[model samples]
Target: MLNYRNALRVGTASCLEETSVDVSYEDGSPDDDDVPRRAIVAVLPPDQETRILMLTTYLNLARCASHVGRNKDAVVCATLAAGIAQHDEHTDHLITAKILRSRAHLAQNHLKQALRDSAAATELAPSDHKSVQLLARDVERAKRAALRANKQLAKEVSTWVQSAQSKFAEQGGNEADCAQQ
Candidate 1:
């Protein structure tokens, strides 16, 4: 049988397999944010109660990080908490982790990822939970923010394309005149 430390190591390794963003949009590299994967829970033991306590700590850390505008840090903390709270007995912690993660993603403007986490939390929590209602409102705010960002990006792209086309036409006209001469 594996030693307790070895089992904890293996468990931590397995938990790192989860994707950073569940609903990816354009192709992109994995988020190698500053938070080291193992460092987040390196001292975790195999005990269930300790794990639950650590989950609470991480969730609190995530909330504080988000409040300070450190969204990437918040995401990392919440993700680690979620990984630790995977057992049936830790359902409430898992829900809190998902909600915190969703908020972090929303702060970072990752609309799809935020929605995915929010949905997971909603599914896990009772329909009448106060946090679930708050999450619904957060989702609405995220949708509006995403729409505004999309509109801004579209305008920027259109302007860039127009400028590029005009420059190309100017170069083509100059080349034609040079050929005639």
Candidate 2:
């Protein structure tokens, strides 16, 4: 018979494994169903160790969400993980959460928020840590990419709106009414 602590760990790990397998089978696109919700519930045990495990699970879920273009969900999971890590005084998890959140923000074209999160992650990480340095570099790159993408998106949207207004005006419609429509 497993001890209570060990059982909790095993259960949490099992839940993580199940979710990862399910995510892999979906080719990086998470289902808009109950799998992630169930995983979150499964990992929420009351013990400290289990709480740490829950933090890990949340981080993993955030990564999965980011992978599948669910940037909003990724931000929510990463923020929850960061909050839990802060409450538990887990610096490593906190740093990971910040990094993940930064990436999610970048994916969502929130460049400023991504840069802020990257700065927080750098401040939280030890100066001598090589891995954290790499993470910071990656975040910087993502920020730059997001800036360029945002500029292009803005230009495209401007062109689209102009075209729409011209077409509406040619059809005897007012530009203001076309915008509302």
Best candidate per lDDT, number? 2
Cα lDDT, all candidates = 0.70, 0.71
| Backbone atom clashes (below 3 Å) for every candidate | 0, 0
Which ten residues in a row are the worst by lDDT in model 1? 1-10
Off-target runs (Cα >4 Å) in candidate 1 are 1-43, 152-181
Residue pairs in clash, model 1: none
lDDT of 2 by residue, 117-138 (tens): 8889889998986756876787
lDDT of 1 by residue, 42-77 (tens): 445678778778878988999999999999899878
Error of 2 at 11 (Å): 27
Each prediction's TM-score against the native? 0.62, 0.53
